[model samples]
Structure formats: C-alpha cells, structure tokens
Target: MITTAMRTRASIVPLLLALGCPQDGGTASEGGPGTSDGTSAGTDTTVPTTSAGTSSSGPDDPTGDTGDTGDTGEPPGEPSGNDLDQNALFTCRDQPALPPADLRLLDRYEWTRNVGSWLSSDLANNPLYPRPEHRYSTYSDDEALDPSVLGLYLDSVGGAADSWTIGKWDGGRLRTVHEDPECQCFLYDAAPTSECVRYFVRRYLEFGALFRPASEAQFDALLAFTEGVLAGAPDVESRPAVIKRLGAAAWMSTGALHRPELGAGEPDEHGRLQLGDWELANAIAYALTRTPAGVPSVNRSYNAGFSKGDVDGDLGSILDAARDGTIKDPEVVAKLVEEHIGGIDEARLDLLFEPHDERYWETHSEYWMAHGVREFFREWLDYGELAAQTPKVEVAATSAWSGYAVENSYQNQIVGFYGYESTLDYQLDDMIARILDTDQDVFANLLTSRMFYTPATAGYQENETSIWKSTAEANRVYNVSGITPQTREGRWIELPQNERAGVLTHPAWLGAHALSFENDPNLVHRGKWIREELLCQNVPDLPITVDAKLSEASKSQSARQRMSEQIDADPYCAGCHALMNPLGYPFEIYNHAGFVRVEDHGGPPDGTSNLVGMPSPELDGPVTSAIDFSQRLANSRYAKRCFMRQTFRYFAGREETMHDACTMVAIEKAYDDSGGSFTEMLIALFNSDSFQTRVPD
Candidate 1:
C-alpha cells in the first residue's frame, strides 16, 4: 500500500545510512569526531548539561518568558539567538519539527574552493577528485559518500596538505614560514619543544583545520601524532616533511572534513535541541563567509596595503564570542551579519564575470556579497548550467531567409574567449550582481528590472575588454537587441521594457531553457522551472508508461499551435500540461535561439498564455507576452514569499516544511522591514530557530 512518494522517501534513508553518518537518536558514536582513527578519546559520552541555571520546567517555562521563545519554547540558556522578541510578533500554529542535526558534508563547489584557497592547489580538477552529492542548491548536504570518494580522500589528503605553505605578506610580497620567527620551528626543528607543538596545533588544527576549539583529547592526540612524526624522522632535513604529513592527518580527520551540528547538550522539554557555541560559530561562518575562518591567502595578491577590514581581527572576534558563549545573543548575531554584508561596493560585481582562476582571487580579495548569496541566484535561476552545457549548435547562415542569418550571426560575436552561451551566462550574472548591489527590492527588481548587461559593460579588468566595436558589430541583433554604446564603462543599458522584463526574458535564460538545436520552443521544461521554482508548487513526474514526446514540427503551423492541437487536446497529458503549457506558451515570442520572432514557420507566432489554478489567485490570469507575465510575477506577494521559501531551502540545506512556519514568517517580515533587501533576509534567517536549533532523532 506504499505510495510512490513514500517509496522514494524510504529509498533515501539507506543512501544516508550508507554514508556512515550516525542516525541512532541523533548522537555521535565513540568513532565520531576525535576518534576517527578508532582510538578512544576517553571524553564523556553522555550529553553535556546546560551551564545556565535554567531547568526542565513546564512546556512554556523553559525561559520563564513565553514572549521570548514563541510557540516552541526556548532551550536552557539566557535566551539563545532565536529567542529574540521579534520572533513572537508572528507565531507558529504548527508543532516545531526542526531539521534533525547531522554531519553536513561539504558540497562539490565548496570542496573545490577549499582545495584552491586552503591547499593552494588545483587538485580538484583531477579525475581522482572525490565527487560529492549532486543537488540543485549549493548548500544541500551530501547524504552518501561513495567508496571511491572515501578512497580518494584518504589518498589525496597528504599531497594536498603538502602543497600548502603558511606565509605572510611583506613589502607587497609573500614571505615563507622559514623567515617567520615563530613559524620557523615548523620548518627546521626536528625535535621541537612541547611549546612549539602546542602553538602549531592551536594555530593550524584548531582554527585552520578543525574550525572549532579542539577537544582536550583531540589536542593530545594531534600533539602526540606531531611528535611521533618528528621523532620517527631519519634526519633534520625530514623536519620539513613532517608538517605536511601532520597537516594531512588533520585535514583527513572527520572533525575537519564534516560540520557536526549535534547540539552539545540534551534535548529541551519541547524536544528542541540547541547548537553548541562552536557549532553555532561554524554555522554562521559557513552561512556568511563560506569558510571556517578568513583566509586572505584565498586572494593570492593580498597586500598589507589593502584597505579592507582586518580579516584576522574580525574572525578573532567571532571565535572569541563563541568561546565566551556571547554569540548566543541575537543582537550580537544581527550586528555580525550587518558587518559581513553591509556597505558592499558595486565594483566587486566585476569579479562575478571574472573566470574563477588563480588570478581571479589575486585581483579580488573579497566577493561583492557572500559566495553563498551569489550561488543562490545562480542555482535559483539555473543559469549556471548554461556555461557547463552549451549543446545548442549554431544555426547555419542561409540565403533562404534573413531571420536564419540573424540566428546564425550570434555565434560569431566575440565576447572575450567565451562561447555564445557562456557570454549569455556572464551577461545574466552581471545583471544579477547589479540588482544585488542595490540591495533594495531585490526579488521584484530581479523579476522586473529592464537594465541589462551586454558585452559593452565588460569593465576595466585586465583580462576583460569590451568586444563591441559598434552595436551593429556586436551580437545584439538576435542575442540581445537594444544595447547601446553607452553601456560601456560599467554602465548597464535599459532595454526596451516591452521587449524584456526580468532575467527570464534575458537571452541567456531564454536560451538556457530552450531546445538544443531546433528552431521550436522548449515548452514543458521552461514551464516546469516556473511552476516549481518560482511558485513553490510541485508537479508530479511523468509516468514511465507515458512517451512524453511532442508532436513533430511543421512549417505550416506555429509551435504553439501544434502543442495546442496535441498536448491541450489529449485528456491524459492535459492534466499536467495544463499546469505548465499555459505558463510556457507566452515565451513563444522568442525562438529557441532567444531571438524575438516576427514570423514562426511562415506565420505569426502566438505568444498569448494564461495562468490558471495556481497557488496565487493574483497570478492566475491571461497574459499577452513574457514581459507582461514577468511584471505580474514581480508584483505578486505570493511570488515574493516563494522567493523567501527558496532562500530558506538554500540556507537551511533542506526544503521548508510546515514545521518551519515561524522561521519563514520571520524571514518575510525582515524582508518587508528592509524594503526587500536580501541582506536583511539573510540576517533574519541566521537568527531563526531552524538555523540555530536542532531536532534530535
């Protein structure tokens, strides 16, 4: 009697279990964290109790202040971050079913970024590099680790560690540890004093590797491991080799490899578990900085002359607060969030178009916003896929029709060295960065902004040059029309509002969501993205018995006409197509190449479509074109809430449920309070219960 959805859910549990994460009552076994080597750390296995004087009182008496805790009572403490007064403004009618705590594995993008920044190596490009889980959102945790991935992690950790070197900037150049008085012990001393080893372990292992205050047992184990490496060496020359091996083991340890969110103490009276100080620190760090601590070396060209805020000092404050448990204050967290995201310069947007090469980090030390923020837009819009997969073949220029030449000419437009698809990707990224830089009405602007980034807006970076000698010479005819020469010098041109609306009408997005090589439109998938992603609604998968193929193309009829005759008329397919096709048909104004179509298959293309039976009654209406539809979507309150829902999924690393009602409501309020600023929404999310609290299995 199990339904298909139930069976699918059941299948994922085995996949999670196979990954070696413990699922027994939401606790880590003896083999967890400190004892990855199977050597018992001899630390207390029992959950730690709250240091604060709060006891397991009545359901609403956990904090003795019902207003502070909202519907789900607060954990034992002097009000953790989630207990802010604003949380009580709206209440959760449903029971709190916060996501259970587990070890969140870093995604593939993070691993690659870490390998480059921390190890200073391109080893992530190797075929041997471990492949993590694949998911739409960058923040989704990997549930299973393949055997091959484990083996690769074991084999590659040592070499990756060896490639890294601790250095300082001196006179605008990098100085090795050999020249540093304190760091020199690591390079030359074979039989270093105990004091030397402790400093090394604290500096590299605690902050650099484990990303938290190492447990006493962990510290002793690593200290012993470091001494053993030095003592077992054959010569004084071997001292240098010891550091890499020591670093490798630290990097390989589970404490460094996975982020543990199991709350330090027992579950509260409401079964709500609270994250420990160190765990919360890391949670905020990953949410904001995408690292355990700041690594200025991530930007290889960092000089002492740079005017950005003190990286070490800023991270030191966060760590100090974690150790003192002052990070539990929502006010403290809100201030930290402001410091991280506020006052971002628009110039940083140039980095988005920069290829993520070694030079990319050299020229730009910090991103415009958090890397996670940038990734959310890329993943949400699904435009990042265009750069990786540009399977659309260039249409051949033929004398048969002038429109064919227009579609074919785009491939020849030189925008640096990128392919036509990649150019579009970069262009869309540019538009997104501009919107984000404003930090006002972000979701609405993203949907309705007429400003567009063309090739002329490529900025003054050394590797980038404006490819357009003239508007006619550029690829604007079919690719992106109405771009002016004034778009140069980092200026974005306002495209005709009638021709374009938001990013959905952008050539890159339109083309990315279109058919491979055919001149016909890709209806279902485009509609599917809009239906599920924007509306936060689900459409069931097509049954395996259904062939799902569209009717063959005909020069006599428009693509929409053919689809209407076949898909709309068929009762079996009409059910789902009704949900999607109406949403997609409006986009038929643009062809597969993303060119505005005047004629389709010798006839005028029908771009009229309507939304019916949607979650928002405001959105369910007739539309003349994609532009009008996009404007409607931008203005709809339901669509804006859906954007917040999507943002929660990216940050929380899971889908939002009824259990997360309180968090979602708070986030929406924060968005409204800040005039729809993404920065404020992130602050509200970081302070939400679902982010700071856990649920024990």
Candidate 2:
C-alpha cells in the first residue's frame, strides 16, 4: 500500500503533466549547444541516463568519485562533518530510516536564483513574488517534500524563461570545459565552438537547477514535454524560442527537478544515507552565495554523474585551485567575502555607479554581471516585498485614504525611505559584508554593533553640513545638518555605544514593524522577527476559529494600552503571544522613524516585559528596554545557537529538524570553541555528517 506521503507525490506528477507540453507546428529543431538535431521539433527524442544506479567514467568525470555518481545499495558508514563521537552525542545518533528519497523542488526564490546564475543575469523576475515567504516563521517539515509546492510552482516555471537568452550573458559561447563565458539556456555540442543545445539543457536542469541527475525514462518524458512546447510556438526554429522551451520545461518538470536526499551516501544499518561530498560542496556554495557555485563537473555518462572538479566559469570558479583540499572551511568563507560581497567598504551612490566626491568613501558596489548571498538576503528579508508589481496598490496615499497599501508603511517609510534609494537594504548588505570580513562573533556583532552608514545626502553634498563622524552623534544631547537634525551622514559612524544597539533600533527595522495610521510599534511583529529570524523559534499561528482580533478602544491610552487589553486577556492568545510580546514591548522607546524617545506623546509609556524562554538558563528575565534586550540577546547562548540554526537553514535550504539536533549541537560547539566566529560555524556545518549524508525514502 502506498503511504500518504507517497500518494501525495504520486498525485503531483499527473497534474504537472496535464499542464501539457509545448504546442506543435513550427520550424524543425536544429543542432545547438548541448543538444541534437531533428527535422521537426517533436520528432527529435533522446533518453538521458537515470540519476540512480548508473556507472560514470566519462571524460569530464575522470575522477569518478562514486560519491554521487550512482546508487550503491550497500550502506556506507556515517559521512564526515561530525566533530562529535556519535555514541557520546545522542541516543538517536543511529537513525534507522532516513527521510524518504523524494525529489526536492526549488522554492520560488531558489528557482529564480538558480536560473539567474546560469544566465549570468541578475534575475528579478520571479514567479514566487508576492507569496508567503518560505521563511523560518512559516516553515514546516512537510516543505522538503516536492509535492507540496506543485500547484504554486507550475505557473512560475511556465513563464520564467520569458526574458531568457541562451547566449546573452556569456557572449553566446557554451563552453563546457571552462565557462570563459557561460549560458544557462545555451547547451553544449561535441564541437568546441558549437552547441549541443538540447543535450546541454537537459543536463543543466539536472545539475544547475535540480542539483541531481535524471534517469533515461525521466529524460524521455522531459523531452516529450519539451517537444510539446514547440507545438504552440509561432516559430519553433527560432533559437531563442527553443532555448526558452528547454529552460522552462526543465524548470517546471516535477519529478526530475525535485529529487532530494537525506544528504547522499548508502543507507546505514538503520537505513540512513549520508550526504555525499558532492552535495556538501553544493550546500556550502549555495548558502554562502545563493547559487550552485559548489557543484562538481559531471561525467559524460548517461546520468551525467559527479566527480571532484570545480564548476567551470562562475563566481565560485575563482576557487578552482583551492576548493578541493588546500583551503580550510574558514578560508572558503574568507574568499567569498572578499570577492562576492563588495559593498561593505563603501557607501552606496544611487544615481552614480562610481563616486565623484573624494572625502566620503568608496561608493562603488555593483559588479557588471554577478549574483550572490547579498541578493539572497534581499529576498530572504522580504525587504522589497512591498514594492513588487502585480499586487498594485497606491502606497503613498494609503497612510491617509486607507491603511491598505500592500507594503506602503513597511517598504516606503522603512526600507525604501528615500524613495528609490534603499539606504536601509544597502546598510544591511554592508552589515553582512562586515560580518563576513571580520567573521568573528558575527551574531553578537550584528545585534550589538554601534556602527552605521549615513548617506552623503543633499545637505552634506551641497555643503550645508559636514559629513563627518563627529557630526553624526546619535545621542539626543546633540544634533547636526538640517536634513538629519538628529544625526549627520557618511561612513561608518560609530555612535555612542550605550545610546544605540544593532538593527533592532535601525529605522528600517523599526519602521517596518510599526503602523501607518497610528505610527506605533507592532510589538508582536517586532518580537516575532527576533524569535523567528534570530532565535529560530516559531510562535504558532493563532487558531483560525477565534477571531484573533486586536482591541483599540483606549483613546486616552498609548499604543501598548490598546494591545495589552486584547492580547493579555485570552489564555489561548497568551500561549503564542507571550513568546513575541515580551521582546516587542522593549522597543516602545523608539517611534516608527527609529528616533529615540524618552516619553510617549499620548500617555505613559510601558516599555517593559519579561524576556523569557531563551535557551539560556540565566538570560531569561525582565528586560527594561529594547537596548537592554538587544545587549542581553548579544550575550545569550540561545541567541547564538539560534543564529547557527538560521545558518543551517540558509545553507541546507531546509528547516532544522529534531533529527538535526546532534549536528546543531556540534555546530554550536564549533561556534563556542571558535570564539563565536561565523566563519567557524559555517565550517562546522559544511564539514559535518549532516552536510554529507543522504537519506533514502
């Protein structure tokens, strides 16, 4: 009998098949990079090798590392990356049955991110836009199962290639041995200069997008589907049309694109598969840069399996000589920081690509053609979620006419405060850059840093004021330029340490978590971000049956008064609300604009709440304000461990499970031992058993 989980995936295949293949009737197929020729689009058919149970000894796969090449029914011992002894770690170290060997589909972000990597274009055109973010708060264990994403994923895949050009980014050269210039849409032909376009597209779907191989049967089905796409194109022979068809088909195809493993080696006696070295390389690459930078070169075998070779020509290709053995994990992270994240050393100049003024700082951050974790965090934090198209709502007018702009208050006032100049997001980008550069106690520094960048706005640029560090004092005792009466602009202004904290007090975060009409702090939201994004905790959704309403009748009372009446009264509400509300109340000292406030204008301010449930034994207690809370958070063991959990999720591309406990503990130990360095934490995760182990269904 099929299990419920098995049945769920079984149902998805037919639904995707029903979306139907490309429409017929067009110019005949022609040879292209990584493809073959045919008289008609649908007539040409080929069967690629299956992902499993295959031997690899191709020219490209000379090493033939058997790591991820084919299935070895025999169980391999636990993979590496585990620093702790299993017998001493936990009783459940020997997991009998690994997760089912279901295929893992890309969520919307990964889909766009992967394809964008292939094309060498920074693709902002994502189908997953304007949906619930696959974030820590909404994350569920079922998410790893490919079947869950089928319905929402279909439309995204179908139209994704609208802007794609096989040869656009890499100057149209489909180089296999080396990507002097590469193209996701461009396939490889046997000739050095020509394209085996069809063949290459299928392989890319497996290696680039799916991060796995496909079987002969799977390729036949995918080819049939691609041929169907040609049925509808007005001109099938159009090279662009064909290229788009291949990318879209592979992207949308459910079965091949979604193959997942517990991390991949043979099953253990308890039936466990360790994630292979191949996948470990991938996990490290994607987490740091948010692309398939770590994937090894494939053999020409039918399944096109793996060997230990670097990705030919992309951002990570820079590490070709060092990735395999020379560099330790910390060095790997160091290289990524220097090359991929370049914004930290400068201030952002929105209109000009390069800075004209000399006194301010290095204001040039854009690299001609590149994508990285900076891009990933842009989506990860949903910083521009309010600015997305399709869900067109008037944001400027919503604060008065209606409180219904999609992200008006959140985006416009906070992240995009200075119109198109997203100073806040850039600030965040800088923070990540700095964290990676220093790579020590990253979580604590992020929470406690007093450094911030203030742009050289019109006032300073126009000579109305000086853009110097001394000019930008954050304390209320002094002020500066007319535009920024509280603080001036330019460089990394080190504020008075006691008066400021990290991003929690940042205007972007504060504004994002506040209201439009009342312009008050949304403690629940502010607190939730900390719990979910930082601590990796989930405050369960309010029960649907209950209205879960907020009361606002205290006209004479302050913002907290209105919320306290409703949220604190219901025992059912307290179950979840308590986790968030406690931390949120501390931020009442700041307004939506992120300016300091000693008093509330309306009534007495109650900026006090119990800081409880942190994993640390002594850190849980009453905190006086957001300042105190942030400082305590920087010191808490729970917060640091939680930071690792987020790292695992970011790199692993899945939420951490109870089964991941030993891995998490080991990573946390590395963090502790390494003086809480983010670099070491990353090393710990990539070098662990979980990083290299795969679990079969």
Candidate 3:
C-alpha cells in the first residue's frame, strides 16, 4: 500500500484537486466539501458555518469578502501603474479551502469508495452481480461513477487507510471481497476458499462502512472507546458483541462466510464465537435491533472476555470492538486508524473528528517559536498591552514562520530548487526566535526599510559563486566591522560586505536569471516575474482580441524570442516589454540551471535586440559568477525599487500602490541609512500601514 510516489506527491494531489475541481455543487461556489456549518453537527440544525463570513456572493467575489480571515486586497479604480491592475494578484479563490468537518466527511466517503473499489476489483472474476450506483437525486444520479472517478476516490481513501496503518496495522494486508453462492445473503464464512480474500473483505466492511456511520448510540460508544483507549484500559468486554456483529455483516456481504447459528459456549482463538448456521443467519437481525450505543457496549463486553489476561490482545480486542460499532470516537480509534491509514489527514482530520496528531502539535510549536518576525510589527501596529506577552506573541509569530518553512521546505524545494532537499529546521527555528525576542523597534525599523532578502552564504559551499555564497561571507563582515578580534570570534563574519548591502545589492537578480534559464513554455510567467520583480513594472493582461497571427507566429520561436518579437509587433507589448525585456535579457546569459553559459545554441550577443524597435540599450554582459552579476545589477535604480516593491508585496500579501508612497519612501530612506541591512527593510514594511490595516476594495 505504501508507495514511493505517494511520499513525493502527497501535497501535490490535494493542491491540484483543490485548484482544478470546483466545489461540491460543481459550480464556482463557496462552502464546498470539508467545510463545516460552524456549529457542532449534533447541536445545531442550521446550515454549516464557514470561517468565511456570511456572504452569498459567488466564489469570485472581487471584493474578497468570502469570510476567511486572510485579506486579499484589490485596490479600487482603473489600474494605472505599469498598466497592471492591483486586482489581478489574488489566487486564493481558485482552491477548495475546506473546513475541518467537511474534510472528515470527504475522507469517509473516499475511504468507503476505496474499500468498495478493492472489493469490486478482487471479485471481478466472481459471478456476483455488480451493484448499480444509488440514485438519490437527479443531479447525483446524472453524475456517472466512472472508473477514473472511482479510482480517485479509492486513492484518497487508500491514503487515509495508509495513515491509519502507520503506527497500528503492522503490515497486515487489507481484506479482499469475493463471491460464494452457498453462504446466505450477507453471511460470510470464516473459513473461506481463500484466506486472504476472506480476511480482507471482513476487515473492509467492518472498518470502512458499519463503524464509520454517524448515529446516536455509535457516538456514545465512540466516546467510551476514546476514554478506554486514552486510559490504556485492559478490559474491553463492554463492546465485543458489536465487533462480532460487524465481522458477521462483513462476512455475509462478501459471501466468504455463511451465517453461523449461535449457541456459543465460548469464543475461539481469534475471539470469534463458534456458532451454528442458524445463529449466523440471525446476525443481521440481531445487529438491526441494537442502536449505535448498544453495539459498543456489547462489543466492549465481547472484547474483554476475548482478551482474558493478555494486555496486547486486550488492546486489540478493544479496538476491534470499537471498529465493529458506529462510534466515530477518534481517540478510541486513534491507534487503530493511525496503524491502518495512509494519509496527511492525520492532524487535520483529528482536529475535526478525533484528537490532533502529536507530530503536528510538536511541529506547530517549533514553527511558532521559529518565526516571530511579523508579530512584533502586528503588536506595534495594534499598540496593545498584549504585545508585552512574549510567549503569546511568539505563538502568533509561528504562523508566518511555519508558512515560510513549509513554503521553503516543500514549495520552494519542488519549484525553485527543482526538488533539491534543503535543510530548513535549524535556520527557521533560530531566525524566528531571534526575531521575536528582539526589541520590537528593531523589527519595526527593519520593516520601515525596503530590505527583505537576507543574503547569507550559510548553506553555500566556499567555492560557490552564487549570490547566496557571497552574501553569507559578506554578512560576517557586516556583523563585525569595528569589533575587537576577541569579541568578533563568536560573531558572524561578512565577506564582500560592502558590495552586498541589501536584497537589491545582493544577487537578487539571480531569480530573473533563474527564470530566464527555464525558457518556460509560457513566457507570460517568465516575462511577468521579470517585469514585476526586476524592473518594478507590472504587465496586466489586455482585453480579449482575436489575434490569430500572433499565436501563429509564436509557434516557430522560443518563448523568449517569441515574446521579444511580440513586443516589437504590438504597441501594447512594446510599451511594457520596453521596461521588462531589457531587464530580463541580461538574465538570458544564465540557463535554467542558474549556471553561467555563453551561447543558448542560438546566435550570441546580438546588440540589436531592441525592446520597441528603438534600438534599446544592449545587455551584452559577461557571465562570470552570480556575485559579479549582483554587483552589476546593484547599479540599477530599477533593481532597488523592485526589491522595495517585492518586499512590500511579500509582507502585505498584496500589491503596493502610489497611495503607499509615504511608506515606500520611509522604507527606502531606512534602507539607505542602514547600510542596506536586510533586517532594516523588514522592520520598515512591518511598521507601515500596508502591514497594519486590511484595506477595503
């Protein structure tokens, strides 16, 4: 069940699914699957409440009033700067963003589907008739349950099952379903034609279906299981009957076991009671009579008796009892589920339906302690007494830190580094704690400046020529400029210190260089990043126009060249690319690998690469190292402002406008005054209004 691909694509599937698929209703609607109606399911009859407040607006609420706490600031009025609208930046609306309860329901549905698929597949050669899809509503009935859909559902369920298996199942094979005509309808024979098939089908029905349903008595039994499991109780005699009933149903459903006649004297080695055919025939009848709560109590009693004196057996029996009933108590089933399941829903699901994952708690705690940089700014903006509470502040600080860690550890690793494994634990922790514990004003001041990127060669090799390498060595020099030799021993050393001042002064241009190398099939992304991040320009999309020739002409050229030619062909493209293409052109010297290269298998160093056919300034730069490139970039005023804009956007999670000129000026001044220390810029942005207030659209 465990596969190598699962480990790598764990995050990818969910993200892609969230983005690609519409919500449960199959339209661009809010409140999709996994989102709760806010109140407890048992207490309130009202519709589920989402964190996204009461807005009946369609999913693409340009105003961004979808009720989520996070702000997606889209400035008002016609777009002006660089001809790009501020509204174009938000992408959060394109995803599922489900709540906890709904997520659990989705998990349950997927799990059931997975078990069903496995059963169907295993019995494919069997003569049993295939069941038709349940027709509940016209819409539901119309949606065909195709193999692909079933496969996706199965995959999700399998993931959850795998997660459960992690600490509990111990490599037990999943139960498989088969057909047998001799067994009564829904009666399973304990001794089947195939042991593997019998065991799998029995386990699947018990765990995947009967036990997961929500009913009154099942809920009670779930609570009981939770209490017993947490206490490590050895006796589970209270829930055995439920387990037996569950096993019986599963056995019957698969036709692997016949309904047994019950006149049981004692249980067998596997804790199953010996029964006559008549007893097995009456199993479902007995099960139907008991309410959900009644089953758990019966199961508990059966488990206690079955385990007798063995602690491990007692625990296993208790779990089996819980699994047999309709109790959804995660705590009782935590060990079982964890041992049997396979997915990332461990913590998120636990938060909704069970106890939270201990690993998540630990990771979250560490994350909070590591990233407190923005908290100080929030406090300074609020000017509240709560700011004095460093511990709480530190906790609040972890959100950003954890976000960065995940972004760096997962997203950046996959996209930016092309799956390179980067060590983030130590750096994230140290940076977060230090940022939080430091004086608020230090950070406040740091944000007021436009210094966001910290240049450090900390992880780079000594001989590396990347900007990170130079910055690391330079940071040490900046830290110990005039300090005594003895005192400086413990301090960080800086190299190329003067040359590498702030993000702009460092080899921040490497990002553009990196983009250039990708030769991305889509030039828009490459051009946009170059325009927005390098030249401080924003290229908003033009109105839909049927330009067949443009598309046709682009087929023959590389993305970069096509874009260059397009800019020349259109006045619209020309105006923007004039500010974008030149800045991005210098980066062409570096390949997608971010390595220096002389030729790109095309002619080299054409001086006539005009932006708008005006014979633009030549970007015939030599490729030696990222540091040399960084120094060359440092001369451009556009680079400086671009860094400032990027820092503001990153801190605010939105774009900057002319209205933010005051904050930008202050930040620029701070950066100039602080010798371009990265910390200075961060402080400046954090203290600004852009960081403090949630702007209205």
Best by lDDT: 1
lDDT of 3 by residue, 527-569 (tens): 4554554455546555477342345545544445766666656
Instruction: Summing lDDT over every window of 10 consecutive residues in candidate 1, give the lowest-scoring window.
Output: 46-55
- The estimated TM-scores of all candidates read 0.76, 0.63, 0.33
Per-residue CA lDDT of model 1 for 1-697, tens digit only, reads: 9642243233222222112211221232222121222222223121111111111124555432322221123333423222222223235675564665555555544554444332224445323222233334433233323454554454455543432453343221112222236555665565667777676655555434555555555556667666766777846576545666666656555455566676756677667678877678768867665654432223334443332223232245565556567778888887777666534443453242234433322322122556656667777887766645555554321112244323333543323233222256656766776777788999989988988766432332233434322222234433344333332333356777667788888877877787664344477668888987787667788899998665464434666877788779999989988878888888887766566666666667667887778776889889999888888899988778778877877777665556677777889888999998887888888888888887643
> How many clashes (backbone atoms < 3 Å, residues ≥3 apart in a chain or on different chains) does model 1 have?
0
- The lDDT of each candidate is 0.56, 0.45, 0.29
Give one clash count per candidate, in the order shown: 0, 61, 105
Between candidates 1 and 3, the lDDT winner: 1
Which clashing pairs does model 1 show? none
**Which residue segments of model 3 deviate by more than 4 Å?**
1-527, 540-579, 591-595, 600-633, 657-661, 693-697
TM-score of 1: 0.76
Candidate 1: which stretches are off by over 4 Å? 1-91, 115-121, 126-142, 166-181, 188-191, 234-240, 299-317, 346-367, 395-422, 457-491, 551-557
